[model samples]
Target: MSLIRSLRLDPLPVVTTARVELRPPIASDYEQWATLRGESRDFLTPWEPTWPGDDLTRNAFRHRLRRYAREAREDIGYTLFLFGRADGALLGGVTLSGVRRGVTQSCALGYWMGQRHAGRGLMTEAVRGIAVHVFETMRLHRMEAACLPSNEASKAVLRKAGFSEEGLARQYLRINGQWRDHLLFAMLASDPRPRA
Candidate 1:
């Protein structure tokens, strides 16, 4: 790779399928982010945090950007944007958070998408791309994910990304408000990659 190409995550991998573009979120993406997320309020509330339904202000968006920047520097994990490649319309967000390096190089994968974008194979493709980026660019050893037992869609995504169904834990995570059971899935460096 050229020095500039090596220095930047440019050529951003576009990660396009027939309908989606999985790439890094930019400084100007907050507007669409708010729209898609806000619209999915009811659909996502059951699985995610209960934020104010219509409270995505510019200030909050700036705060999110600041956190993203800090996380990038600290190598916490990456939060990518999902969009329609042809028109560049925002769809949702995908994250690989809590990254740890050294002997136990591993990170946890997490993601959320708007209701309209759900059920398509876009997320599966996005997850595959994130796994590739994690193992190749970040040089991580393992990637793990937690999903509600009832979330078949999420389980499918992990399986497509080459994560094995490890086990189940009671009250594995606090979802929305109460503790919820989560199934654990993981992918090791030795695992084979999966196609979109």
Candidate 2:
């Protein structure tokens, strides 16, 4: 193969819902991303993993982009930032990680919404849009997600996106510096999607 073709990464297309657009983060998004994450720190920290000391630094964002590019090149993960379609405002981000092929054909879904943008149902729309990209475009067989049992908003988003609750996982993940139990949810390619 030519050098360019050999270095090509898997396509990560922009996905659009009614009010949100999902696309991979670019270098220009650094300022907006940093601002949003910084502002939402208090609101998001309770449900997210403890932030690294330099989490919002430009260097850290560069590292994130590098990691994302590497993951895409390896066909192991995809990360997209959600923006308001009409005003082009950064709303949040979604990640489809830990992808497995072969008989599995599955990956994990993770997301976060800016504090200012929460409670608007934008996340549900973004999740649903990404689901279509996952099942139809990426051709993955299944998508999985988990959230702390106490997170009613996250649970509602998953349900609205047509994911069925599977079961609870003990100490499934570390959030806010503590191991927390999480409720697992999954959706298969054959599953019916909610109307948009």
Candidate 3:
């Protein structure tokens, strides 16, 4: 008989930093997540795929939660919402997606922050925390990230978090309604971390 594998993580993992906590988004988080995304629309839209007309609706959030749960159960991805450690304020979100195990143990990293939280080094902290989890807990070999070449803030965040620029991807993804080119970056499990 062939051995079977159980691919579920009960009570999804939560990663935390000195100032923030990152956990999967739950139904209780809907209002905060929606409010922050709504307020940051103009600040975020340029770097993101165009939002669905009902993106902030409760029904949409329910759909998102279901997908996140399914991906987690399949060991394919983890999407986490960041919150202030002290006040528990909603900060933003980060995701480790497109996970590939076996020969290519790697995943893609992506994140977004509220406009008000920008320029505070919070995203850098979140990225570092997630990188640790990806490397140590998940034992993944590599993590990749991509951003519009013009998004200098994102590039800086990736750099500070120990990811090295890899190259450019032509029209890698559709952002704000158009296919856009992106600068790619990657961090390997064997790479040295930038000292704090």
Candidate 4:
């Protein structure tokens, strides 16, 4: 993409809440992102996609930027970095992916928080911001989140963000070392919105 095109396609602007900021990851984030993953390898390995040995390389971050920019231009996946507004520290990220419009305007939600950031209700608040953007701003009718049946933390975030447990999906996705079943949760436009 040309510089002008890239500028025009700048990932969606920052989304902020009283305690958090959802922004796109920049090149400068490489170091901290690398360090975070390095230290949290054990903490995140079970739930995350398989990470290759080279995933932390600088070039990997470059590829991620390109993917984020492309996804933004296509309105497919707007991945945002989560931050603690009080100190502007990187908390983790939230994403609205698989966006589908027309007769059914809907998408899926996925997120992760740094180890230290878990259980703090930060991801819950961030999910609320994401819900508002996808449902109200983008006019999407439904937003879905499914997590491994064992992920109580994620289930709590989904429920706290106003999604109701829909059911279980077998082999919903592959994570870490194998295919995993997920518990489906969804928040339709008709569902009560979480207080932001």
Candidate 5:
């Protein structure tokens, strides 16, 4: 028999915070997601990678769901959509990718907030809630995030979520078709949780 055991999150996950709920995206979310992304295109494009021509289409969403499912099945990543708890509005998304096991026991974090929800502190709450699931439930050691030096709002969110700025990376990622430098940050499981 093989020694490897499955790490599949069979039922997926739904994480709740004070103001938001984080859950996996579903087929029914395509309309809301596409509308929100379409409206926020200008506001988000500067900080995000270039989008494909058909990125907002239902077919693209189906492909995205397929990829997410494969990642979850292989225990490589988790992607959750953030929604307003009271109104059930889709506000943004968070992804924990590049999940490393064995000696590393870590993952990379990425998030995006809709234009309407920017500066609301909801993303911070979602990040903290996901951190709890990552460290306590998934038993991971560290979560790392990197953002452009000019993204002050993102930096603030990470800081409020208890991540400590580590250093700078040269051309860490491609944003808006350009390779950009990024400020790195990390939060350890052993670190004390930030109080609200």
Candidate 6:
């Protein structure tokens, strides 16, 4: 595969809520993305994978964009950045990944909010909007999410967005440099949207 590939669809669909907009990040967004992630570093580190030495660099961001585009084109995943509708500030990101098709049409949800935007209800709104896209627009059967057992806020957000706790996964993922247990949550296409 080449570093650059053309996407069949021109201009990715933009998801909007009352307070925010979700869209794929483009090249020009590098600076704002870097700044937002930098400011929220300490607040976000615990729930995320360990940052690389050059995690904040432009080159790394370029690599991320390429991967996001490639996966989206291959119909396996989607990643969107959340921006404040009022001021266009970079707020955070939401992704539906690990997609499986055929017999099981499903994907996993992962999201994060900037420290300043925490507890504002924006992330919840984004999740609901994206869930609609996943089930209705993308026609996937189910969406799943996993979070650290200690993450009460995340657990609540998932519930508010219509995901029911499924079970626990022991040492599910490596987070902040350690393997951690995570509680699983899922929503199916037949599940009614909580905010609908």
Q: In model 6, what lDDT does residue 159 have?
A: 92
Ranking by lDDT: 2, 3, 5, 6, 4, 1
lDDT of 5 by residue, 101-187 (tens): 899999999999999999889999999999999998889999999999999999999999999999999999999999999999999
Q: After superposition, how far is residue 8 of candidate 4 from its true place, in Å?
A: 8.0
Expressed as tens digits, the lDDT of each residue in 1-102 for candidate 3 is 112226343457699988889999999999999999999999999999999999999999999999998788777899999999999999999999999999
Model 5 bad stretches (over 4 Å) = 1-10
Q: Write the per-residue lDDT of candidate 1 for residues 119-156, one digit (tens) a residue.
A: 87778877887777778877889999999989888898
lDDT of each: 0.79, 0.95, 0.93, 0.86, 0.93, 0.90
- Residue pairs with colliding backbones in model 3 are none
Instruction: List per-candidate RMSD values in Å.
Output: 4.2, 2.0, 2.0, 2.7, 1.7, 2.6
Expressed as tens digits, the lDDT of each residue in 1-196 for candidate 4 is: 4555556633385888889999889999888888877887888898888998899999988999999988878777888889899997888888888989789799999998889778889999999887877777788899988899888898888888899999999988989979899999999988887685
Give the per-residue Cα lDDT of candidate 1 at 47.
83
lDDT tens digits, residue span 79-178, model 6: 9999999999999999888989899999999999989999988999999889888887788999999999999889989999999999999999999999
TM-score of each: 0.87, 0.95, 0.96, 0.92, 0.96, 0.94
Candidate 6 error regions (>4 Å) = 1-11
Residue 7, candidate 4: Cα error in Å is 12
Q: Which residue pairs in model 5 clash with each other?
A: none
Better model by lDDT: candidate 2 vs candidate 3: 2
What is the overall TM-score of model 2 with all chains considered together? 0.95
Backbone clashes per model, in order? 0, 0, 0, 0, 0, 0
Q: Find the candidate with the highest lDDT and give its number.
A: 2
- Choose 2 or 4, whichever is better by TM-score: 2
In angstroms, the error of model 2 at 89 is 0.5
RMSD of 1: 4.2
Residue 43 local lDDT, model 1: 89
lDDT of 6: 0.90
